[model samples]
Target chain A: MNQARRGRPRDAQVDERVLRTAAGLLLERGYNGLSIDEVAERAGVAKTTLYRRWPTKDHLAVAVVARLQDDDGIDDTGDIRRDLTDYMEKIADALNRMRSAGRTAGRDDRSAGVVAELVAAGARHDDIGEMGRQVYARRNALALGLIERARLRGELRADLDAAVLLDQLAGALYYRVLVTGAPVDRAYAERLVAAALDGAMNRKEIPPCP
Target chain B: MNQARRGRPRDAQVDERVLRTAAGLLLERGYNGLSIDEVAERAGVAKTTLYRRWPTKDHLAVAVVARLQDDDGIDDTGDIRRDLTDYMEKIADALNRMRSAGRTAGRDDRSAGVVAELVAAGARHDDIGEMGRQVYARRNALALGLIERARLRGELRADLDAAVLLDQLAGALYYRVLVTGAPVDRAYAERLVAAALDGAMNRKEIPPCP
Candidate 1:
């Protein structure tokens, strides 16, 4: 109640400080090292305040990621290939950042780290799972819209399944990071977009009418 | 040493019994309920014997999944569409099985279940991660060979990136099951294969020669 009485300005400041401190700690020490008490102390906020907002480390971690993802806005330049490639590269950058979190420079670590923990957190709790899915839904909706626009404009086939195409483009990045332990970079993103758009089936030329 | 002296017959029996019991427990209670002690006791094997085979529950779970995946053999009927669709369906079936593991029948539970646990297990341990990657590599290699054969026969474009094509196909299924909480099925598998094999670009017919 007293915190509420302190009002909007103070509350915003507290949230900003807490999240910044938590994000730094997470990137430095990974998921296991992100202690709420330490974050509260560093942020100059009470433990009660942090817990009242985030509830658990998983919540705090998810919040941190939500903030990071919020900055990834898709732009539609009317060119589906370039647009999709840009979008995929953005995703790859975010994944690469999280993948390299808490690890030393110049050292090779193939561990999924905080990314795996975040997925596990969603699977472990129903509310978190719902929240994570909502995040994906919101982000994916934008990409889906972009694809639909391209399809309508005759850039893509009229019969195209936009959702599946988006899934293929985004899924490849996630698969490399989560499953195959493969590297996802701009080069890979370009290749993925090309393969998906051009497709695998060879086209046969129709005979000219005499 | 004594067990080795007991010969191949007893060793095969022990492995079969242990895996069967583990799979049963896993399906009934999910990942958390699977304990090595219980599996060993139910299988009538020494705890040491179980440990010697699978060092941890994660190892046992991975082994169980490996057994499940082993039955997914790709058939090359020279028709890439049918083969790819069949392969995607098999993957969907496997994903659905793990997705439903430890949940009540007909109950709506979006939890990824044992599949999530297996992915986390791979992330947690290097050896487990390597083994999981190897499993994926082997399975994908078979599918790649199928795609390559189709390409050579002019069924597909000669310049198609088989790896990227495979990634899109398999990655979409995993993405749906693990991230979006979507239900993957045979129908969805067919759509996915169609979208992948057929390019998304709008086709423009060449003008007839005068």
Candidate 2:
């Protein structure tokens, strides 16, 4: 056990290097181009060391995404609409980045790229699916708290379902990217927030029809 | 051309049989289990004939889904909430059916199954992606028309963004099925529609703090 303890520091360093290399490769080459062999060669680590850590490329890819998503912290500035819109912008930025990753600059890149692959990977493997769900759960909890605060503060409706609100906001972005092949930018984010926050029912009285 | 047209009736029959057989297999076995060979054999058609209609299993699967979704006609009862809820229920039913397709009875089938596979297939192939977008376009046009009618009738806001509203309604359903692994049913659909149609902002007058 003591002998194994001696290698722990070196193991941590190797793990960082491998993950950095893997992230670069995944973003540069998309899911298909990310080869474990290439990652080991670039990271100056043995294949056994890489396998010992990540076990498989899918696991390694999931880790890279987890790291990439670490910076998406939600901020509650007491203005629920602005806060939610800003939050949606952050999500759109991450999704747009993932959507364009690992393709030639001039080539057609309308496809979902590595993002769709990671989603499919989650469906293909239970562990990956669980990890993806856990990631969403943590992020959603933060957003839900933000919504709850708004509701408590009388900013949002008392009967609002925070989870459903978040779902509508985030889900529209995902649906656009993954299904509709539509572009999601800050302007679109603003429109999405406005639509969700303001009810679509006619508030003004209409003139009687002839 | 006339001679080719002479085989048109038989070809249409074969197409129907292949699609029906493929849909059955897809529902029974999920995506991976719907083999082309098996579909051809079960349809009692030659392998080449099946191949001529659907070049690959993904193509066949897409055709099956397109057929499955052909009957999702939206109802215009003049009440936007009830109409949209009914529309959403239709979408949820289709998604729930796909989510549970090809799984053993009483088994845990939370995975996206065929839905995620079809999404991935769209990302993997351009033609499939086009077909998917076209299907959504047709369906969405109908829903948008319903929304437009409601807007004209003063049920919805005159300045409402119909596409955004529809996106929110449908996007939430897809997001739950594909990402959150949440159960989407009539009850959930009702809640979702209510959330979208009724704004989340607090409408009641807030009493001054003591």
**Model 2, DockQ value?**
0.52
- Give per-residue CA lDDT, model 2, range A38-126, as digits (tens): 99999888998778877789999988888778768998889998999999999989887777777664334567777778888888887
Report the number of the highest-lDDT candidate. 1
Candidate DockQ values, in order, are 0.70, 0.52
Candidate 2: deviation at residue A39, Å? 1.4
With a 3 Å backbone cut-off (N, CA, C), the pairs that clash in candidate 2 are B28-B102
Candidate 1, residue A141: the lDDT equals 92
Lowest summed lDDT across 10 adjacent residues in model 2 chain A is found at A103-112
Model 1: DockQ vs. true structure: 0.70
Q: Per-residue lDDT tens digits of candidate 1, residues B41-114?
A: 99899999999989999999988877768768999998999999999999988888887877774447777767
Chain B vs. true chain B: TM-score per candidate:
0.91, 0.90
Model 1 quality (TM-score): 0.93
lDDT string for model 1 (A67-141, tens) is 778779999999999999999999999888887787664335666667777888888887787888888998999
